[model samples]
Target: MSNTTNFKNLAPKGLRIIEQTDSLYHYARVISNTRFGYQPVSVAYCKDASHVQYCVKFCSQNNKAFRIRSGGHQHEGMCSGNGVIIIDLSEMNKIEYIDNQPNQAWIPVGKQLDSVYTELEKEKQIIPGGGCQSVNVGGLTQGGGWGYSIRKFGMTCDSILAAEIVLANGTIEIVSEENQPELFWALKGGGGGNFGVVTRFKFQLSALTDYVTTFGLTWKHPEDVKEVIRVWMNLHASTEVELDPALSSSCTMILANPDEKDLDCDGIRELEEGQKSFVDGRMGGQFYGTKTDLIKLLKKCFGEDLIPEDSKFTLLKEVCYASKKKSLAKSEKETHASLARHQSILANFLNPTSTPEQEIRATNECKHRNYRVLPVAPTSTCDQPHPHKVSSSFPKKYTCDDNSEMTERIYDFLSKCCYYGDVSKYMSFHCLGGAVKKNVDKRVFAFSDKPYLLQIQGWWDDISNAFDNQSRNDEYVKWVKDFRLNIAPFTEGSFINFVDQSLVDHPETHEGLLELLEIYYGENNLSRLRKIKAEQDPNELFKFKMSIPPLIE
Candidate 1:
């Protein structure tokens, strides 16, 4: 940490370097609230592959540990560390589509999800990616990106045709199935910052549809919450129900917040002063079809009576409808009304303080659109950084009736945790097992065989409060850890994308790096990854607390 002066001259010409003395150092250093206090020696903002190579070479020569950062959204903040150099890739944001092959594109590792989605939508194409817009393609694809369209097209890593990586030796290599196949395989879902610095990814893109339907349904009542969760899980895991591959959904069960108010078509309705605490469950996702077809599919899955009356649904194409259209059928009018309702709900869902005027403007702007535009702003939730702790796992398949004890335990944890602190807490069940499990043998991403991905999350808004109040922050972190432990019996393997540092710290759950690797990559895949790590980065220059180390010779 003391040799800070050497970094200034080590940075290549045209590369921007922010040392501790620089005014922008603080801003460049902290990416996530969890890593707010991590003070890096310097942050090198690499613009392209050459700059990345220079930074890698600098770190190698100085024998200084450096962390690779793209979107900087790593849950545990391993993308950064205290008193080390950070090779920041945010400046290398660019996308180049292949001329004749419209279905393929080379995206820089620094490109965030929002820009990627917006750029691809212009070409009527998209890659399967997570919902968080600020997440960079580097870490996301490396950890096996999951999104609403995953059930249709598979993971983001699955679409990776090739990658341009700077190895530990400062040598650049473009890896793919046809070249450096083992390294390429390891790149897919092997976890980021494990192997080397990935400069860009050559992705095999999928055609983007114009009229996909997105829906949201909330069940506030306790009995209704349990019933919705039961039905949703059954829809994904039940062999008796022939669920469509075109539909991908997730359910979130949130512990009731005393400060939260209910907002409906009427407006905000305050909760009763001393209302008993309960869990609120919401199930919703996108369908690659029209509203009419989506309604039919939902009815088939939930039955007519089970479908909530106030459920919100809308078509992506509805945003492109011309306001001056001559005549509308009764069904079309209902669909428009539904779109309006959806906008209202979405605005409030993202920001409760959103004014009625903002809601109307959001809906009205959508009416005159000509091209396909994303209905909801993908960056709404992730625009600002907050202190959060998350742990994820692939849950084993279980029917509603067969897992009564597990269900009760999950509910019990959710209900009891609300009284501990004011942090926002929820468990999200992301449906899997459609295209996710199709070609598992060809990729390193493990746990596709599991029915769904369960993420236990806790978020705190005030960074100052989080750092100052140790006990308060501990309550939030402990809640996530305790909840994850409660459901350990029902889950198989951990998701590398939602990496947790505590897994390595805890002795009971994992003995050491080997056990942690097994939890993240499975036994067989872990061995393969270790061998590849040895071959590509034998020196272990790219290493962290949870990073995969080279196999001992």
Candidate 2:
């Protein structure tokens, strides 16, 4: 725990190394620093590719495993381990335009997507990537970056022109289709934290558009969830491509929050003895055209003759970069209503005079993101990160003609929702198609071409409550677990980015995780990726919960 530790002493000059006892070490090491815990030997921040090369060599010489860290929105906290050395890449973020090729740019793996977007905005170019602003370029593109423009442009990896990777042997290679064709193929849309430390990415940028027509529609009647999902599958998903590749949609069925009047003190902390939550659904997306054409197309899908009375739609004012902020003015109204509810909920436990300040603090702390625009402000950095769990699946095509069965399943899924307070639980479905299908033959990324990706999420205050210390965490995870099982019969595969390892006894070698691997990278592509791993990292030095393993034991 000394200032001049061996980890620091061994580091190449100019590299930043922090000991385990340092406050910065905690923030530098983990993003999803959950209550379960991940302890690393030391955290080293690499300024450039040379630093990464030295760190890998240093780890090998010291008989230690090393994990990569980028935006650290890394699901499962896989960046940390008992005796691992963390190659922290947050400091390496830099976006530089390739002057020779005006349409091309070099982006560091460590830069968050929002920061990348903010930087690229000046250039008036775009990269079809993530909307969840905090995710980094390395982790997201590694797992097939999908976003509003994906249908128009293809996955994030598809836009890459080249990359600079530092391998296990500390050799830095400039990889691309022409140079290291095999390595280039593997890096494009391959899962994150695998292969090697990708220090820099050379991307082919697309011209930015002025305004993207985005829309949000919700079903008024909660009981209509079943019929609406059926109509979506029957009308929208089946033939979206007939309209235009630029148009896409994502529909989700979620548990509705309790009425604010009912969310009294007992409901916020300890739930009322027996209050029930309702189920609702939302469907929304964007198009590469004007609002008029978007609405005309929506009418075609919903039935031009007669739009459903229960449905409501709105066109957002935000452009392509902020396209995901499709929340209408109504959502803003809902936010004010929610704040009022929170104020009342806080009044129960806090002094009346201090409630306003506490409520404001709670609102800011929540990181309210639904109405956020471009340069989506990220939560303030902190050493003490909160804990949460999420899992996802891909149902390639919905064949369930029985609306009642789907409705019953939806009810059953929401039935296990938080029985207590303001803690939230819901399901999110994102639409997939367009260039995804056209680009499938490219064989570059891990994520498959699927019609829909479903996110099963649960969030709570902390690790637990007073009665059962781990109950809250257990409950949140179990909800996703049970929901996964219930929907297993319907879903064909799982999204790699979701990173659920509850079934894999040994992610390093287990067949169960491998089964999910086939779903992610496909058997043939996976074989190719494994072969590359075998040759590049024969000893499997860069192994973690979900990192690609070498060909053999």
Candidate 3:
């Protein structure tokens, strides 16, 4: 029989197999980074655990290489590769709640963050997850997911109660602390596509608050970039001000644009007409509290000079209206009555060019039942595929004197980096603390005690024409590489979720796979992870470029 006939015979009934001849095969091959020409032989769309088992068996018996794809959001495109069979779980997404289990739910690995968030909101529950809505629970949880609520609730992996996985031998196993303890520990924050294919996760959910206050503050002047970083770092550490544990924030600094008309990868111009046309810095996050309390906290931390008294009152009234709260007294409304004035002040400081109508529409869309869940701005870009590269590091807290030097280095890069066509370059710092420091020995996720995670990211449009101009791609790629090098001394370990291929493939270092693994899981955790890999996948059937290898006996 032919290869196609053999695959069809082994596949379960109703399992869709998209071959290279099929029209949808091209679409199946596209990942987050379209720059790498990954051409999979065929894509097997698995709908359930049975379908996954059959595909794994076929690949094992036929000696065919395969890669597992949940959301295809892997930074380096390791989820799909050239000439490999793709086992896609996009069709297997489903959320199930157990009887009498109010604090937990079973989430299929293929479910994206947006869908999970919407479904969990129905029960007034949440799981600490990443900002990008398209990132699926499988990869995010496996790589120690970070989010705006990270400081309060900890990572997505920390919430995992158990997981159902299919081993290379086509055996299904439920892994938890009691069952297969080593494998269970490895599954939590040991990186995706390593040992087995995780089909579903039983997550321990947290109670969602009735209301949340989301705030954004920007420093427009290039000269104030250092001060912005210093203050933001102090705020994250709670050194200058005693912050509430319910608050979590991130700071981002964007490279200045050479031309005013150059659009970013999001198709928005960084330098607006009336806005300050310089290196822009923004600090924003979600606060599980009322608008009144958030305003008080910000004013105390940032001072009245940066956050004027008038602007604070305007923000308070705007959030009250957006949330549709009726608690504001009529006399208080009359005291701060100008709605247009509130929106104008917010537009000037927080979100540029935002009107009252736009704010209301966005707020209404994010509303779940009666509760208000405000997502941080720059919402989901899942539909738009672009070429991008990211490198990350978890830096420890520095003293005031040390912070000054680090701030200067970061400011220099943001001010001097070259901008390519339609490329957006920035550095993001996600604060880490509070509950993240509670459980250090339960999982393989390292760097939980670190202060924050920093990501050096670059994205550009026109993915179809990326290869036509090699120099443009090189310039953008080199910019991120150089920035990573500049901050190498201050940073320690890298985040596995933000995997970078250059760490192993760079010409200067030529670091081995083991060295790259050390950077992600540390030396001690990596040793245990390899042993579990040996137990689960002895033949290395489920392997990728950055996957863990079986320990040699």
Candidate 4:
């Protein structure tokens, strides 16, 4: 049958095709809407994975480029391209609790993270996942999701017990540890939309215990801000707290300060006193809210001298003071895990040196100029091995006890952003060589093993300003890649979920993708992955630029 005829017959009976006026607009919508700048050729909203198979088959027969979409949350939009047929799985939103008693749930590919969380909460259970509620389980789980529960439990990939996927040839297969185990290994943390189109995920749900505590703290004075960060890094490194605060360690240039109006006499005096030691005079600072022991820690870090006038200290103190009062009744045996769970706490130790005043300002300037400030940190902060090859923190060096060289290497990376000269303030989080690394199976979520999960962002309200010139954009991306490359010796892996698409053209940095495969499937099992990719996708029709790269010779 003709390709056109096949597509017509394959589409769902009630499915509408707008080829005339709305056709281009429909495709354009998915393309321009992606977080990454990747352009899309066309888009088809599938009613189910069966519809996805039909779209794939149709694109295959026509020799057209294609991409898959499941709640486009990937920082790098692998689901979009110039002339690709986008199989949007947004319509396949069905979530079912398979076993409520055992805390097992089956979720379709299209359902957003928030929807899943809401639905699952009704059953008094929750799946371990990321913060972005709109993200799809298919992509997030495949990439080894990490969120609020990351420090407490592990990742979304670790909790996954099984999955149902549609192969390239339109055959549906259930993959798990028992069935097609090798594929299962590759699927977890291998990056999604590569092996096959996932339809549903079987998540191992856990009992939702304790109320999630959240708060935001802000600092205006450079010196006080530095002090706040310095103290946070040091405290987090040494102290083991039951409550984990997902700290935002990125630099910011505040055009408008929300706390500026609220500041009064006492708050200003405290902040000024805190800045007395530093050459720069302290101005103001405030906490948006308070949670757990975070307030006390902040106070201890900055000291009372640096507090601002008319600040919200009374409320903060009241909460912390009350919480501590309540905790006195409990036993010391109800202990929480500490910073020791991580292999290294260099981020905290080197916090003072890396994030000093001048670099912070420069990073803030980068934000002002809308240039991407890349975040760099110690490999010890990561959960697994970093993608970097030269100096690694994972597979702890028991033999070489003196880690001064490794420490220096980390300081240098931190210095790139924290120090006085050429400091970049791109954001990154700890994801390597910690409890998550030692406890979880790296083969299942190898990407998380990397020392750092970075978010290289350039904030600009103007759409025309981002890529005004491709060369400038290229330079910014290359600089971030260079930062990653420089750390390759220390870090042995990279987080795929945090990958920035602008750097996809650079193959060397992406070497982590290959390393990820090795960690999961092992050298022996790689042949099987290649064979499956070849057999299921002979034309390599379903492949994305950053998905599964052909195994090199």
Candidate 5:
């Protein structure tokens, strides 16, 4: 936007505008704040697409900053501005379905996740979305939405059939695969607010089943977690993988810091400084099929026989365990045994004193209804408190050995930061095959080819004044980066949803964030995006940190 701007006499009728120093400044700022940094000059409540168009034209004519806000859950607050105009679409939170087109619907950017779910539940339909309930559809879809039904359906972007956008020239238009195909393609997993102000999105929906079966498995023992992870990476998380489409689960675990002192946390059971951090690993999700089929698929985690193969667990009936010096059969048996032993350990952790319960859990992996599949309510602030710095690694290839070598590396990396007593840090591994790989171009869409997404999350829950405790924040930031680098060998690349400042805008870039841009979106896609940015938003209107840079700039 041009710098020679003037807001005097700019207020328009039918627009609810809140200027700085207004009584509603705090509320307006919160709505637009990324929880990172924000101090917009004013926020204009847009009731519809026409208002959004007016905002674009108004800002363009005035040469002022302008960014759009729906849910305001951007990792780096890409929708925020310092002293700019914010097109708040909160009033436009509306949804409508196409007649006889149960699979297609039109939703606005301001609608929250939970609202969509609650409304869809009434119709016995569902839209694949993130876990957080308050995340707006705009940010989630643009960043490639993931949910409990991701494998069954696809990312949220894949569901988008069309979008209603207000371009930089104040021209409102519809973009779909058939019209403005390039811009439409860019909107899907191409990052939001780059092409235009997305007021409404036409999404494809999926029908929900009656009483989805939720399942889960946990591993508490350190050694068991290591082996369990290895088996996962080898089978489910593997790139050359063939998994049951009905079954999709994430293998996530966290290591607590053994050295965490009682004074450091509240409500947590106190432990000695030297005590090792407890390891907690869980995997499984709601299955769209019967219990029998789900069981068979889960059994693949261990040898088909559900027997322990480790040398420690003696196989009762094994005549010749492969003849040649530890033959293939022998190795396979040992690996199977290791997995069973790990499973047993995990089951026991869940039922410490009840041997019967532990045995049953190990025998029956699928528990009662998969824990309520829900999304965390998003915070208005930019640097979200739950996980301050979330860096994700999407690996299309991986190597896992029965010796538990691969999982050990993951454990070694995880147990360091989330260890010492911090329960906030975690490593999440998601199965990436199924529908995600089928729709859209895997090479272009983020995390399409990479079947396994690893989220290395760091929390800022020290309970101290964040503003005053800059050093503490820095500590966690450093730990997150250091740990990510250490596991870089095992990691394929980062996920765009879990943005990293260091990678997105690396300090070493000559004059721009060129390096991180290519890293986020591959070179070809990034180039195409740049050209779109040039042609569509020549004035560099819609932008923030990590957005596509226009050629004119």
Candidate 6:
């Protein structure tokens, strides 16, 4: 722990290595809040790719496992506690336009989402990305970045024109379809930290439209829950392709805040206030719930009979049944109105009840859920084309749509697996769509012939003694694995940002990996990548928990 320690003697000349007793927690919580594993041997902060190369060489020479760090927001906190050397990429923040007319920019992998947005605004360019302000572009794009722009633009990966990567053996290489198409496809929607350390990315930038609109709508009362969902689904089915709405929903339990709740004896006003209070408290507490794909649930709730089967694969589901009681409290006036009309439309669907109170009681007893839906923004892509690229599994042309679809798909899968139980909602991004299915050779993401839509989501709350904590975690992991297992048969790939931590357990979950190989190396892509891995750094100097296989020696 000393400044003059031998450990310091091995450090890179210009790199910054912070090794101290106080650094554990700082490194431990980088971006992931999940449970931890064995802590790192130490943390090393690299100023640039040169430093990263130095760390990789050092680790290789000394024989050590190393974890890459960019934004600490890694879902499972995999960057820490692996008993490896932590090469923190959070310090490498640089954004510069490599070409302006073509709208291309070179961004360091360490930049955060907020910083990127702020900077892009200044540059009069925007790369549609995951809206969560805290997410790092490195982790998000590598993990299949999705956000408000996906539906309108496509995914962040779609915008990736090229990248500078330092492979496991400490060899620096520029990865693009023309240079190393296989590696390029894998990195797009393939999940990061697995392939190698991404020093800088050359992204295709797009002009930001002057007209941007945002909207918010809320529904109250338990009786209206099902109706609201039904209406929302119906609306989305015929929704104008130009209008994208991010959707979300939840059920609540009444809270005891007197200020929020009034004495109910006076009437509906008190009841309405009480309902608001309950919602606020619910947000304050752990939400026991689920977030599902609007497209999928639209089919589930309204029946798949309406949507074409070919399009069903585009639908996603995330379900959650809460152990806590769902509230049905409503103002007397609202209840009275619903009861009056109950017999006319939905009345036949339920047990015929005479009074408003009876109707509320019946509706409460029935299943009720809430939802939210939003459209993804469009992606930024390189201008012109890189034609020399000759891989079957790779896409010849890069665009924002590629990244949008992948991220939205992952959002659907993750919402189903991680947050299913207390409440449910849906969201979508206004992204580029018409070009999703374009068959661009046999390259990666060749699932369809049209542009794709993207969505984003967030929801969850803890429940004490709800389900055994250990059991819940185990169940969550299993659920994610099961989905990954089933995903390949239906679609070409999934969203990278929503990449599950259990990718190691089910390699098939990453259909993009093999597909990229097929496109880049043709029939022998994996073999070629392995051979390149060997030629570049003969010794496997860098590593991640899961990665492309080394050449079969």
For candidate 2, lDDT tens digit of each residue in 212-313? 555665553544555666666554356434436677666666554433232322344221233254455666665676666677766776665324332344
Model 6, 491-515: lDDT tens digits are 3333334333333334454565455
Query: What is the lDDT, from 0 to 100, of the residue 461 in candidate 5?
Result: 35
lDDT of 4 at 153: 54
lDDT of 5 at 494: 66
Deviating ranges (above 4 Å) for candidate 5: 1-14, 31-35, 237-241, 257-276, 291-296, 300-387, 402-406, 418-423, 462-468, 504-512, 551-553
Q: Model 3: which ten-residue window has the lowest total lDDT?
A: 354-363
lDDT of each: 0.72, 0.62, 0.71, 0.48, 0.62, 0.45
lDDT tens digits by residue: candidate 4, 171-243: 7888899998767776776677877888788878865443333333344444454454334333334324422
TM-scores for all predictions: 0.85, 0.79, 0.83, 0.64, 0.77, 0.56
For model 3, residues 370-479, the per-residue Cα lDDT tens digits are 11222111211343456777899876547666667777788776655443225567787778877888777886778876767888877655333334346656877888
How do all the candidates rank in terms of TM-score, highest first?
A: 1, 3, 2, 5, 4, 6
Cα miss at 405, model 4 (Å)?
Answer: 12
Task: Kindly report which residue pairs in candidate 3 clash with one another.
Answer: none
**Predicted structure 1, TM vs. truth:** 0.85
What number of backbone clashes does candidate 6 have, counting pairs of residues 3 or more apart or in separate chains?
93
Deviation of model 4 at 191, angstroms: 0.9
**Candidate 1 regions off by >4 Å?**
1-3, 258-276, 309-381, 419-421, 462-468, 504-511
Q: Write the residue-wise lDDT of candidate 1 on 209-260 in tens digits.
A: 5456667766666566677677777777767765798888787777664334
- Pick by lDDT: 1 or 4, better one: 1
Q: Candidate 2: which stretches are off by over 4 Å?
A: 1-4, 33-36, 239-243, 260-275, 303-315, 318-385, 400-408, 415-418, 444-449, 462-469, 503-509
Highest lDDT, which number? 1
